[model samples]
Target: MTLDFDQICALLPHAYPFVLIDRAVEVVPGQSITALKNVTGTEPFVQGHFPRRALMPGVLMIEAAAQACCLMMLAGHPSPKPLYALGRVERFRFRSPVRPGDQLVVTAKADKVVSTAAIAEVVCRVGEVEVASGRLSFGQVGSA
Candidate 1:
């Protein structure tokens, strides 16, 4: 099954410009997820990233991965999904530059999950090139 924009909005607390991924192509509850992001020249950041050359910021790739990880973490939860905030990033590597018109395929697989925290292995790729890979950790946003 796939999650469209509206369904993604329902499960996530993000809105336009902030919500990175465009579609959830595959989801396996707490185990893993794969999403897509189609970069465009009209994206807000593109105009300013560079006047002559525009490339996707590495930081945003990581953010996209984190968001995908959160979706993987949330898919298995009961109704009224809990909110999770990125807590840590580890062993991340950027392999290539992402540019507008590229489609980023982000896949996140859960490493560990508990009541308050979860960890995931995430990778983002543009066709045959791996753009970024990392491990991300998340914690429930409102929990104490």
Candidate 2:
């Protein structure tokens, strides 16, 4: 399945400036998702992150990847959406700087899922070059 900007917004709780994923190109319910984020010079972080050289922060890249994983996990859920929280991030590595005009393609695959949590492997790329990659653990909100 594919998701547009509005659809992405509906699946996520984040708002403008924080909403990272622009669109989901592909999605496999309860399995994986491939999403996109178009980096631009207009992003608020560019001004303060580096006034002279704008680079997308590694943390934000992880955030984007995590969001993609959240989408994948949420795809199979029923209505009255369950909240998802970042439980942990592991083995995150930044391979290159992501700059303005770069189209970030992020892919996330569910590694494992239990009654209260889920683990996913995620990666972000600019074309064929990998910009960031990591594993993320998400906890189901209000679950123990």
Candidate 3:
């Protein structure tokens, strides 16, 4: 099932332009998720992130992927008390520039679930080619 940005906000704490994941394409409990972001020229970052050739930053790509992981985390846990954090990023790469009008798709696979933390393998892609991939770690901030 897909969750719109408002629903995403209901699930996650991120807001506004910082909420990189536009919507969740697929959400499976304790498994994996796929999310999407439609890049646009009107974004705040594009205004000054090189006005001549505005492009989405690579870090934002990772953030989007992380937000997808956040979605999956919320789907499984749903406690509303755990605050997600980025613990590590491995094997991440920015293959190409993400321009306006491009649709960024992020896929995340839940791999590890510890007593208080979870890890996921995440990939960010524009099409078939991967733009970034990494291992994302998240932890709960408080008790249920």
Candidate 4:
């Protein structure tokens, strides 16, 4: 399954460049999804993140991972809810700098899914190299 910006906004609370993810290229219910994020110089963060060489922040890369998880959650249901309280991140490492125009492939796999929460192992990559990897925890809200 794939989602556009309006659909994404309906699922997640983040807006504009903060939304991080642009779309889901692949999705499997309660299993995994791969989402894409297009980092651009036009993004607001670029203005202050660096004066001339704009690099996407490490935290935003993690946000992209979370967005991929959100898409996976949405793909499973007739209706979906926003994920709340990003519990923790473990073993997160930024291997390379993500620059403007880089296409970030964020992939997430559900390690566990329950009534109240879900846990996933997530990663961000560019081509063949791993850019970031970590475990992400999510709490499901009642509604979007």
Candidate 5:
């Protein structure tokens, strides 16, 4: 299944400037998801991250990965209010810098899933090169 921008906005708790993902091109309900994030030169963070060189923050990549996992997890429970949140990130490595005009392909696959929590492995890439990889744990929040 594919989730468009509006659909993502509804599922992701982050608003406007904080929403890290663009769209989800593939989703396997509670199993996995593949999402896309377009990095642009004019993004607010890139302007202040450096004067001459613009590198997307590694934390944002992890956030994006977490969002991908949340999307996958949420896809299975479409009627509920948003609850899952990134609880932890483990064994994550940033292999290269993310630059403007680059498209990040983030794929997350479930490693474990429970009623209130989940763990997923995430990998982000640009073209054929890997940018980051790790495992993320998520926990239900907000009245779960």
Candidate 6:
């Protein structure tokens, strides 16, 4: 299924300057998801990350991946709302720098899921180039 910006806004708790995923390109409930983020010079981080040559921060890349995984995990749930918390991030690697004007395609695939927690492998790419990748563990918080 495809999720547009409005749908994504409803699914995630993040807001402007923090909502990393721009759109859900593809989503397979309880399995996988692909999301996009259009990098731009106007982004707040660019102002200080490097005034001369702006680059997307590595941490934000992982945050984007984590958010994608959270969406993937929530897709199959009966209740549409639930807060997800990042429990762990492992084996993260950044192979290339993501710059302004780059369109990031982030994908997350489920590795395991239990009563309250789930794990997924995530990767971020700009076209054919892999920029970052890692595994993320998250869990439902409070009431569904």
Residue 115 error, candidate 5, Å: 0.7
Could you give the candidate ranking by lDDT, starting with the highest? 5, 2, 6, 1, 3, 4
lDDT for each residue of candidate 6 in 96-134, tens digit (9 for 90 to 100):
999999999999999998868889999999999999999
Q: Which pairs of residues collide in candidate 4? A: none
**Poorly placed runs, candidate 4 (over 4 Å):** 80-82
Cα lDDT of model 4 overall? 0.82
| Per-residue accuracy of model 2 over 1-144 as CA lDDT, tens digit each | 988899889888778989999999999977899999999999999998899999999999999998888788776577767778999999999999999999999999889988668899998999999989999999878521
Provide TM-scores for the models.
Answer: 0.94, 0.95, 0.91, 0.90, 0.95, 0.95
lDDT of all predictions:
0.87, 0.89, 0.83, 0.82, 0.90, 0.89
lDDT of candidate 5 over 1-144, digit per residue (tens): 999989998888778798889999999989999999999998889878876999999999999899888889877584656588788889999999999999999999999999889999999999999999999998998732
- Tens digits of per-residue lDDT, candidate 4, 9-85, equal 77776676578778887778778988888888888888989988899989888888987787787665764454566
Stretches of candidate 1 exceeding 4 Å from the true structure:
none
How many residue pairs collide in each prediction?
0, 0, 0, 0, 0, 0
As a whole number from 0 to 100, the lDDT of residue 16 in candidate 2 is 91
- List candidate 3 stretches off by more than 4 Å: none
Task: Evaluate residue 115 in candidate 5 and report its C-alpha lDDT on the 0 to 100 scale.
Answer: 85
- List where candidate 2 sits over 4 angstroms from the true fold: 142-144
- Mark the regions of model 5 whose C-alpha exceeds 4 Å error after superposition: none
Model 3 scores a C-alpha lDDT of 0.83
Model 6 segments more than 4 A misplaced? none
- TM-score, model 6 to reference: 0.95
lDDT of 1 by residue, 22-126 (tens): 899999988899999999998888888887799988889988898888778776578667888999999999999999889999999999989878999998999
